[model samples]
Every structure is written in C-alpha cells, then in structure tokens.
Target: MNKLMLILLALSLLCPAIVLAKGDVNLTAPAKDQALTKLLMTRHSVRAYSDKALTLDQLSNILWAAQGINASGKKRTTASARATYPLQIYVMVKNVTGVDPGIYLYDPQNNKLTPVPKGEKRTSVVPDAVKQDWVAKTPAVIMISYSKPEKDLGDKTLMFVSVEAGAVMQNVYLMCEALGLGTCAVGGYDAKAAKEFFLLKPGEEPVLMLPIGIPAPAEPAK
Candidate 1:
C-alpha cells in the first residue's frame, strides 16, 4: 500500500524466506532460523522459576548470549556504540552445575568467568533490589551494569549505551527461549541502591536485572 510495504511485497515475491507473516513482519525468521520464527512467537516473561540448577553448558550459553565474544573473537553477540562495549555482566550464582554460589564477572574476551572478590556475601541484597523474594531462589540472576565513568560518557553518550544494553537483554530473552529456560527482565529499581547491591565501583551504575532458570510447571486446573 505504501512505499515500504510495496518494497517488502516485492522482496517477498523474490525470496522464499520473506513470506508474509501474521501480526508483524519481524516475526519472520531468516532462512537459517526457522526455529527462531516459533521461538519469537512463544517467547514470554517467566517470573516463577524452578530451583533446579542449570547444566554448565546451559549456563555458559546464557552468558554467551548476553555478552559472549563471537567466533571471530573480535565482535560481540550484541552491537556496541563505537565498539565501546561498556556494559559489564555479573552472575549471581545461587545454583549451577560445577559453579560455586558466588558472583562472577563474565569475561567476554576469554569466555571464562572470574569470581568477583568478596562477591559471595553480597547476594543477600538481590531480593531487595528486585523486590521479589522468589529471586533468592532462582538459579542465577544476570546483572548488566554500566561500568564507564559518567563524565566521560555524558548524557547523550549514555543514551547509546542504554540502547546497547537493551540489545543485550533481547539476546538473553531469545537464548533463554531456545534453551527451554525462563527469564524476566526487571526495571524500576533504584540506581543507587542497585549499585550498592552489586558492589559496583564509584563510577559504575547498574542498568538491568534478569532472573533466569527452569520455569515452574503451571498449576493444574482444580
């Protein structure tokens, strides 16, 4: 009907992968990601999670989807403004296969997690930060925070950083869906309080919180 829609129709006629989709156009996955079409449709927020611990592979993939460096070893899974990937990912590991209960920093460069010094004792603050008691029982909480100094990034630059962080969250959502795990992105937390909760440095600021684990089965009908 319009210029953009007409272009899409022409493309659909040319490419089998560009078939018409219900609801929205982006729901159509590319040729390689047929499963992704279904995954995108079914993805939903999962708040109530089972206490079962995740396998090492599953845990690794979740973190990788968040900020793992790609096979190229030069670019990350998510986009960064000017390649300045300033978001730091921390794992509040209450339960996981082989990994001990502690807070670990995701080293995207090496694809290994390093324990955050004195991080084990700081997790009691999570329940308060997320304002949910059930988070205390979730297997892991992925914490994304802005680590660059505010003065250097400034207000406008931080806008780009926030957009970058959002892309990271979307990747996590899709990854969790594909792995049969569940996750929910949480906002509305007090930045100062969340910063203290993560034990961040003076200039670091917390951005987003994600609680991920196996979804609890729905209650049976009475």
Candidate 2:
C-alpha cells in the first residue's frame, strides 16, 4: 500500500470515533417512498439558474445536507481526527428568502448561519475559478475551508480533512437532487480571491466552492 494509505489505515485503527463519523447520513426530504432514483437520474450540473430566490426551508435543507450535524450534540455530520472537524462552510448569499444577501458562516455549534459581510453582493467575490460566468449568475456560493488540524498530526491531517469535505460535498449534491435545486462543485477557484472575499484567517484556507440556484430552463433554438 502507498504511504498515505498506510498512514490512513493506522490512523483509523487509532481513532475509531473519527472513522465512524465518516458514514453517510441519509437525506430525510423526498423520503424513501418517493424513489429518489428519479432525482438522481435527473441530477445535472446546472450553470444557469433562475432569478427567483430560495425559501428558508430549502436553504436549511441544503446546508444541512452539506455538513449539518447528524447527532443533536455532535459538531459534524462526518468524523474528524480527535474530532477536529477542521472544515468550515461559508455561504455567500446573493438571494434567498429571509436571509439578507451577504456572506455567512454556518455554525454547527449553534445550528445557525451567522451573517458575515451583509448587504450588497460584490462583483469580484472570487476573481479566481477562472472567472466562470456561473459564479455571478448563481444566487449563492458555498465555500469550504479547512482550519489547520493540530500541526503535530502532520500532512496526514490534510488528507483526512479533504476526505471529510468530499463526504459533505456528496451530501450537498444528494440534497440538491432531492430539492430540485442546481449545484456545481468547483475546484478551479483562486484561493487568494476567496480568502479575501471571506476575510479568512491565516489557518483557515479556502479549498472548494459550490455555486447553487434553480437552474434556468434550456432555451429553444430558433
């Protein structure tokens, strides 16, 4: 096995609480009887979304899907080494019902989204991501960041944090599938731009960004 794989295995053996926390949390919406298979089949990476804003419940459901705590008392939906759960999810809201437009931080501890830079949307929120048009077209963007795991853990900590982020991303996608919302996971972003946009701290580094909305319908060619 590769060195990283061996390290991961050793860590898993040493930390079971963190390992079990990585399991999937089944989505509650759309329910089991509704045949989520249909939603999965229709799921697509939508780049163009409608101008309409999302309702509170929709917003809550999607955020929960991304990284909502599974247990009432737990801090993360997925596990972390020493329960580090180093990742942070930031919501950049351009339009959503009840939620004033601005960047917000999802605090699993309080089960609430705390507003950051509230009010108007910034045009250059993220100059990176290759300046993809979808960034501006979408009403909201979710940014993932990792707070440095105990440096004593070494580079292994980064791998663990990344794996945890993957699970959270899947949760977001599945929830979007159930809710009829559109989402696209992006990694080609300018980390510097995102860091500035959120005013991230030294230890907090932006890793991924997902822009979401109700996709605009495909236009008919004349």
Candidate 3:
C-alpha cells in the first residue's frame, strides 16, 4: 500500500468534506508584534464592509492569525493530543483582491488555500445561519469543521478540538482588533444545513462561522 492509498483509506472512514484545489500562499501580516491586547479589546463585530476589497496579504494575515503555522514546526496556535490539530479552516471570501471570490480551505501543512467552488461558500452556509445578513454584509467569513476523533480517545478528543478552535478564534479577534476590522462568531447556525451545503461526509461536521469586515462608521455622538 502506498501513501495515497493510505490517505484514501483513512478518508474513506472519515469522509471529509469536498476540498478545494491547492494553490500558492499569500502572506499578509508583519512578521512580529502585529498588535497588543488593549488594541484587540476594542475590536467589535461589524456588519458592513467598505467596497474597497481586501488585499491577499490582509486575508493571509487574518487567516494566519487564526491558525497559521509558527515556530518552524509547530502551528502558530497551541493544540492538544499529540498536535492532531483536528480543526480545518475555511475562508468564505466575498471581495478579496486578486483571488477569485469563493470558499477556500486553508491547509496549514502547506500554507496554501484550496478553492472549493465558485460561490459555494456564500450560498451554502448563509441560509443556515440564524444571522443571515451577516453572510452577505461581511466581506469574508471563517468556517470551522472538526476531524473525526481518534478511535477510543472518546469525547475528550472533541474537547481538545474545541480548545484548539477557541484559541484560534481569539487570535482572529485580536488580529481584527489590531487591524481595525469587525468580526463575530456564530455557532448557532444550522450545522446540518451547512454540512449538506459544504457537501461534507458523515464524519465532518460544520461547527463554527465567523463574519469579518470593516465596521460601518459610528454616527456622531448625540
């Protein structure tokens, strides 16, 4: 048995969602000291975005902040259970410069984004979310799904994935704060609706969604 066959065997059991085609990586954020905590505290979820599209670099930085690889070998964020790092990051990009607008799966191992399908991200997950406006208003969103737990590891493994995702989500919040972006996490969406939308198989479950964009300006203090 070869590597590809092994992967196929594993996938047969897991039935991961439809994947995007892999492509070159775009790095957005500065190498270090991107922002401080106080600055991130001011970050809030914005419903409107500027018509001006986000640059690839900006998108890259935001995704990186969420769960990019760091320290040469390990991921930028911490994970438990032998670094299984079960959560996958998908970007539903509406108006990014240079890149085609669509749903993209982020591959941390390769630092690449794979295109799932044109318009799939927007349509598939939007209707399932309780806050439907958010899917349209924000220029981008982050979608999270988990890998099947290792056999006999039990429910504890699910908690591990949750912890890893929480850290990544906070990182995204902090980065948005520093970058003057708006974001909100929504877990109350129709998971089954979204799962079918993403064309996920039995083992993959859509767990979280985050809408991100520039906040509309505040009205004058009155």
Candidate 4:
C-alpha cells in the first residue's frame, strides 16, 4: 500500500471509537480568486432536496471544509477568537451511502467520524427545532455546537463562539455549492433540547444546525 493509505489504515486500526469512513482527502483544489468568487456569487440556501444519497467523499469534504487543518501548525479552515476553538461539529446521517444512519462527531485531528448513540432522538425534535419538514428529510444534518469557554472570558465568549459558528457554516455552504450539493443554515431549534439530546457536557450548547442534501431540480420555466 502507498504511504498515505498505510497511515490511514494504521489510524483506523488504532482508533476503534472512530468509524474511519474512507473519504478522498485529495480533493481537486480550486483556483483562488475566480473560482471562489463564482462559488460565493452562486451559493444559496436549498430547502428542497432530491432523493440522491451523499457519498462518503462528499461528507468528508463538507466536514473538512468546515474546520479541517489548514496550516502546518494545525490551524483550522475557520478562524477563532484567541485561538479558542470552542465550536464542535456533529452530524446526523440519514441517507448517506456506505454509512449507517446515526449521529457522528467530527474528529478534525484524525479526519474521522465517531458514532454516537441516540441519533434517532433528533427526529422527534426536528419539528420543534425548526418547524420545517425539510429539516427532518435531508440526508444529513451538520450541527455546530459551542463548549462554554473559560469563566474568565465572560460574555464575550458567546460572541466569539457565535462568530466562529458563522464562519464554519459559511465554509460548509461554500463547499456544498462547489460540490453541487445543497444546504441551509437552521437556527430555529430548541437549544436546550438539542443539548440534552446530543448528551453534551456541562455548558456545551448546540448553536446551529445545517441540513444538507442533493438539491431538487429547478422548476421548469413558464
């Protein structure tokens, strides 16, 4: 096996907690200015989705776009205030190919998905959270959560976390647009219920939920 494959295999064997769903890390890098500008101009929220299933590579790219290591020093794709990356990413998988339906946490360090229990509980709360049918029907939902910062930071911490979540969500949107997929940022959820459902630690709060899928076909012109 190649060196990279060998390393990935080793990681999978060592980390039993993470379900190392194979994803293409070597995504085709896009040109900086023109491509990015195009993506930004065309990106839009998509609430309706087709039945097509998302591939593991697509999921990996989406997660990586949110907070993957960008620099040699392990800086993230999204910036953080005081480098306090309090945001955590969780995904609810419902119709992804090659992955079981469940809730999984993104391990940026390892680039793997770690399964968590009680993912189905999210279904019961989707309507209460957003009151939108699409939220429950999307193939997957990416949730950005915040772990309470040190008490010393005070209320500014919430501001920083919220900004960081915005950055992460924007990255996901741009990535989805580039990948020809669709996603919507949803904030109309019951935070308390989501926190409890996700079994978050004390002070951890679910900040935003992004429902993603293959967008439905455009309506025919009149």
State TM-scores per candidate. Answer: 0.79, 0.75, 0.73, 0.78
True lDDT of residue 5, candidate 3: 87
Candidate 1's C-alpha runs over 4 A off are 1-33, 121-123, 149-155, 219-222
Candidates in descending lDDT order: 4, 1, 2, 3
In model 1, the Cα lDDT at residue 165 comes to 84
TM-score of 2: 0.75
Residue 212 lDDT, candidate 1, scale 0-100: 83
lDDT of 3 at 59: 79
lDDT agreement with native, every candidate: 0.81, 0.76, 0.70, 0.82
Off by over 4 Å in 4: 1-33, 120-125, 150-152, 219-222
Tens digit per residue, CA lDDT, model 1, 1-222: 899999988898898566746554544435555787778887788877777988889989999999999877789999887688888998888778898887888999989998887787455545457666767767888889887743465567879888988998999999999999988887856677777667676677888888888988871222
Per-residue CA lDDT of model 2 for 8-99, tens digit only, reads 99998886554665675544455545666667656666777788787878888888777777875676667667777788888888778887
Which candidate has the top score in TM-score? 1
Best by lDDT: 4
Lowest summed lDDT across 10 adjacent residues in model 3 is found at 15-24
Report model 4's TM-score to 2 decimal places.
Answer: 0.78
The residue-level lDDT of candidate 3 at 138 comes to 70
CA displacement after TM-score superposition, residue 15 of candidate 3 (Å)? 62
C-alpha RMSD in Å of predicted model 3 compared with the true structure? 20.9
